[model samples]
Target: MEALKKLFVEFLQAPTQENFLKVRNAVLATEEFDPYTDAIDGVPKMMEAGELEQALEVMKHALFPNLVLSPGAHLNIAFLLHKLGREKDAAFEHHISQLLQEAIEETGDGTEARPYLVTRTSDEYDYLFAHDLEAKGQALAKSPDGTREHDVLTTKDGGQIWFDVTDIRKVLARRMESDGEASE
Candidate 1:
C-alpha cells in the first residue's frame, strides 16, 4: 500500500486533480480499500454510544494506512471534528470531502450508458446524500453486453440514478470464490 500512501500524501499536500486521480486510481486498483467496512462501520455505533473521540480514532486508523479513499470517510471525520469543536480541522476535512465528491462526479453522468463510477456501494448513498436526495429503492442491472454492472437507485422524488459498480462486483465475486474455495 506504499503506492497508495504516496498518492494520498500528495493529494493531501496539493489537493489537485492530478494527485487525487492518482490516489483514486490506486484505490480502484485493489479490493482492499473498503471505506465502509474499514473506516465507517463502527462510526455510527460509536456516535450513538457517545464516543466521539473513539470515532475519530477509528477514522485515523483507516486514513493513516491509506485504507480509505472515499469521500464518506472524510465527511465522517469532518462531522466528528466539528462535534469536537475543531472547526478549522473540520472545515479542512469537509473541503477535502467535497473535492473528492466532485472527482467522483466527473467520472460519469449517472446515465445507463455513462453511470457514475463508484468503488463501493455506500458511495451510491453518499452521492445521493450529497445532493440532498433519497433513494427509495435499488436494483442491480447489467449492460446489454453483460460486461458492466450497475446499481440503479430509484429516488424518493420519482427519479432514477445509476452507478457503475463493475469493479465492486468483481471484488465481491472474488470474495465469494475465495470463500467457496476455503469451505471446500
Candidate 2:
C-alpha cells in the first residue's frame, strides 16, 4: 500500500511530461487500486502528475476482477480507449455498456469508471447535460465553470451522479486543518 502511495506521489512529483507518462505506465502495470480510499487518492494524485490516461487505466482495472476487465471497466476503458483511437475495442465495449449500467444501479454508487446506460426512454445528451452545473458555498444551484470545474458521473441515459469536486473544495475550505493549524 505504501509503495503504491509512493508510486503515485512520485508520479505527481515528476517535472517533465516525458517522465510523467513513463511513471503513469509503470503505475498502471502495478495493478494496485482501492476505490473508497486508495484509488480515490490515486486518481487526483495521478492527474496531478498529468497521468490522466494511466490513472483511468488503473482505476478501470481496479473496477474489475476477471475477464481481463469488468463490464463497467470496459465501458470506461472504451471511452478513454476511443480517445486513444482504440475503436474496435471501444465498439466491442459498447455491447457490455448495458450490463455495466445494471451493475451501477445495483451498486447505487457512481464510483465505477463509466456507468451511463441509455434506453429508448432516456436520451444520453439529456442525462449528460443535467449535471453541467455544480453546487457549492450554498444551495445545489450549479457547479463551477472555470478551472475548478468537475464532471458529474452519469448513466448512458445521462442521469447525473457521483461526487462533485466543487462542493468538496468548499467543505474542505470550511474545515479546520489540524489542532495547531491556523484557519486562514
Candidate 3:
C-alpha cells in the first residue's frame, strides 16, 4: 500500500497521459485510498483529455492549493494551474503551501473539511463564512415571495419544481460577529 502511494506521487512528478491513466485506474480500483486521491487522478486525466474546466473545478473544490502535492493533490493542482496558463497563481499556491505545511507540522493535524458558507460571489474570491451544516429531506419548501411555505416554482424551461428544505440547510444559525470585522 505504501509503495502504491509512492507510485501515485511519482506519477504526479511526471504525469504523462499514460501515467495519468494508470493512476486513475488505480484510484478507482482501490477502496482504501482517499477520495481526494481519486479526485487528483481524475483532474489531470480529464485535463489530458482536454477537459480543462472539469480539471479546474476539481482542483478548486478540493482546496488543492493548500495541500502538499507529491502525495497527490498538491502536485496535480500545480500542474493543472500551469496548464491553465496561471503560472503566477500556481507559484502563489506553492508559496502558500509551504506556509500550510509549516502549520501542519506545528499543529500535527490532518486535513479536515471545514465548511465555509458562501457570503458572496465576488469577481475574485467567493467570500465565505464558517458555518455548521446538516442534511435534511426535500420537503419544508420555502416560498420565493418571502414567506416560508410548501410551494412549486415553475422554470423558464417549462419545468415545475418543489423546494426541499431537508435537502438545503436553510436554518440560519447565528454566530456572534464583531461589527468592526463586518465593515472590513
Candidate 4:
C-alpha cells in the first residue's frame, strides 16, 4: 500500500505522459497483471459492445484481485457495475475507490514529502465484510467451534466467507520460497 501511495505521489509530482506510461507499465509487469484487450482498455467500451457479463467477470475476478491497489481501476469497475444494474457491487467498489482516493489526498498536495501510512485496522475489515453481506441482503453470524477458526462470516443461507489472515502469510511465504528458488 505504501508502494502504491508512493507511486501515486510520484505521478502527481511529475504529471507527464511518459511518467504515466512508466507507472502503468510497472503495474502491468506484476505477476497478477492481465491486459484489458477488449476495446482500448476501457470498461465502457466493453459495455457498449454488449459484453456486460464478460466485463463484470473480468472486473470481479481478474481486475479486482490485482488492481485493487489502483483508485482509477476501482472507479472504472464501480462505473461498469452501476451501468450493468449491479448497484450493490458498484457501491462496494465505489467505497474502495473513495478509500484509495482518500489515501492519495492524504499525501499532501503533491508538493512536500509526506509519510505514507499502510495501517490495516480491524474496523476496516469489519466494515468491508459487513457491507458485503448487507449488499447481498444476508445476515452474518459467527461459526460455532470445531470449524475453521478463520471462517469469520456465515450467511443466512449457510454460505461461508473465510478471511484467514494466515492465508496471506502463506502466500507471502510461498512467494519468498519461489523467489529463493529462482535466485538459486
Provide TM-scores for the models: 0.86, 0.30, 0.32, 0.40
lDDT by residue for model 3 (59-140), tens: 7665421222222244456666778899987776564444322322222121122111111111001010011212222223
TM-score winner, 2 or 4 = 4
In model 3, what lDDT does residue 7 have? Answer: 51
Give per-residue CA lDDT, model 4, range 64-100, as digits (tens). Answer: 2245445656676787789889899899788766665
**Tens-place lDDT digits, model 1, residues 1-184:** 7777777878778876677667766776655654336545788999999899999998878774343556777899999999999999999889888877887788788989889877678778889989999999999999999999999999999998999988777767776787799899
| Ranked candidates (TM-score, high to low) | 1, 4, 3, 2
Model 4 steric clash total: 0
CA lDDT of every candidate? 0.80, 0.41, 0.39, 0.48
- In terms of TM-score, how similar is model 2 to the real structure? 0.30
lDDT of 2 at 93: 66
Q: Show model 1 residue runs off by greater than 4 Å.
A: 12-21, 35-39, 64-67
| lDDT over C-alpha atoms for residue 18 of model 4 | 48
Task: List pairs with backbone clashes in candidate 1.
Answer: none
lDDT of 2 by residue, 1-184 (tens): 3454454345335424443334333433433321112432466567577675896677565542122213344455566667667789777665455433333244324332432222111122222333343332221223334534234443545445533234233333443343226544
- Candidate 3: worst 10 consecutive residues by lDDT? 122-131
Q: What TM-score, to 2 decimals, does candidate 1 have?
A: 0.86
